[model samples]
Target: MTYIAEQERYDKMTYNRSGKSGLRLPAISLGLWHNFGGINVLENQRAMARRAFDLGITHFDLANNYGPPPGSAEENFGTLLKQDLAPYRDELIISTKAGYYMWPGPYGEWGSKKNLVASLNQSLTRMGLDYVDIFYHHRPDPNTPLEETMSALDLIVRQGKALYVGLSNYSAEQTREASRILKSLGTPCLIHQPSYSMLNRWIEDGLQDVLDEEGIGSIAFSPLAGGMLTDRYLNGIAPDSRAAGPSVFMKPEQVTEERLAKVRKLDELAKSRGQKMSQLALAWVLRGGRVTSALIGASKVSQIEDAVGALAALEFTGEELALIEGILQG
Candidate 1:
């Protein structure tokens, strides 16, 4: 049976302007960092993507090196596009990034023009798309010249390989320089993707200010802090959870007792507000207008439902905010 999107897809979702750009993204965007990999079940990946789009999450994010074997995630997304989402292509805002270790040898990684251009071309082929809506340099390359990196992004835009350019894992100073370079080339930087959460507040130090100053939108990844902010670890780590996965990004040791205590307290606060801890965490990231969207990952359609629920309780009273700060600091 052909899939049809829900008629009420846009009913409850909030769309925020991507910085000063004309694009308005859903407050919650889905990230294909996990569970949509090649080894994973394709039917499940299609379900998550369908559920997300039905809930009005129009933006989907990916990176070239996302799968266990790498590039498989794009292959998975490509399969979904061919089988289910081909008709709703115009309604979606798809994005992908490079600069992480994707292939063998020098041209496979980093911010060099050779790397960025070739990476995007390969990514387009993997996703079976002519142009990605947003193409990001996954991270800054200390050895590469900033001019070369930014210019490659501009060239991709001019060549119609990517509609907009973004930077991920770039520091404030680096972002300012990249934005300036793109502006000079007549291609304004569109967005910045950063790892941010209640447990990870590094972006609050200065990156947020740089983005706001430069009119670059931000979409926060790991808003739940690798599931640490969720109830998933309140009691103990599930053997099947990312914290326990063989090649997990979140090491089991990282889930210390101290962090669990904080999560428990936050969970209580969330209960008082009629939300799950994950929903509260997502809401808090967008509490301030600085972030254009919260990029969430889901292994199941239910996770998407919980994430979308974050929109309902985005407001925090001054006292609640202070209490949260106290728990985080305490």
Candidate 2:
């Protein structure tokens, strides 16, 4: 069948402004952190991207080192971009980051000026793009001076390599410091990406307050807690799920008996609300206005559709919140 988008795609999902910026991103943004690797089938990755865009998931997130082999996911995504989505570039909010290990030697990783600049250039080359909608420092480097890292981000924006700057995996305190340094250089930090989910409340410890105070948007990564918030492990670990695999982010040991019990209670609550566990999880995160978008990763088109469908019924009652907290606390 020839590819055709749903006619009512845009009308289905809600869009929110990123902080105070003129740009607005979809409530759910697709991340190329998994399933778009070099070892994966090309047709599957292409189909996934096509399906995501067709479903109004306009933002696609990538990084310098996403593939199992590193750097291959961006190359693969670039091929898809040129072949299918090139004509609709203006409609897409593409983002890439640096700060992780990418290449050999000391120049390939971290938050130094040399590493950030070189990494982005390599990322652009792999992505086959002149400029990304947003470029991010993937993580904070204690050894690197904040001024030097912010300077690199400033130069990238001024050089037209990226339209906006972002920071990821930064603490509330570090975010404030980075924001100050970036602002001093006249480059306002636009967004902050952090791993946030119902089970993980690290961001709430103070990160959200910092972002709100600084007027920076937040795009939450792993909002589903690497699929644990879903029904995949409520009964037990599914062989094909992340919890059953050797994932870097979510480990099998982390899903203890106690955690599974909490998940089962949450799953029951979801059924009571007439929604799936995954749907409830995504909705819970998006219900808060602080989140600009939920950065999600899916291996199949159906998964994407299922996640997007939750946007329609995102409201939660005070009692529901209280019950959820009770379950989480227990």
Clashing pairs in 1: none
Q: After superposition, how far is residue 314 of candidate 1 from its true place, in Å?
A: 0.5
Candidate maximizing lDDT: 1
Task: Please list the residue runs of candidate 1 whose C-alpha ends up more than 4 Å from where it truly belongs after superposition.
Answer: none
Determine which window of 10 residues in candidate 1 has minimal summed lDDT. 240-249
Residue 26 of model 2, lDDT score: 95
Q: What does candidate 2's lDDT look like per residue over 1-330, in tens digits? A: 445556776876789998877889899999999889998988989888988888889999999999867998999999998888887899899999999988889888999999999999998999899999999999999899988999999999999999999999999999999999888888899999999888988898999999999989999999889888888888788888777777887888888899889989998999998889999999888876889999999888888988888887888899999999999898
What lDDT score belongs to each candidate, Candidate 1 first? 0.93, 0.90
Q: All candidates' TM-scores?
A: 0.98, 0.97
Tell me which residue pairs clash in candidate 2: none
Q: Give the TM-score of candidate 1.
A: 0.98
Output the lDDT of residue 216, model 1: 95
Residue range 1-330, candidate 1, lDDT tens digits: 899999999996999999889999999999999888878998899999999999999999998998756988998999999898999998999999989988889899998999999999899999999999999999999999999999999999999999999999999999999999999999999999999999999999999999999999999999999899888899989887888887467999999999999999999999999999999999999997889999998889999999999999999999999999999999
Number of backbone-clashing residue pairs for each candidate, in the order shown: 0, 0
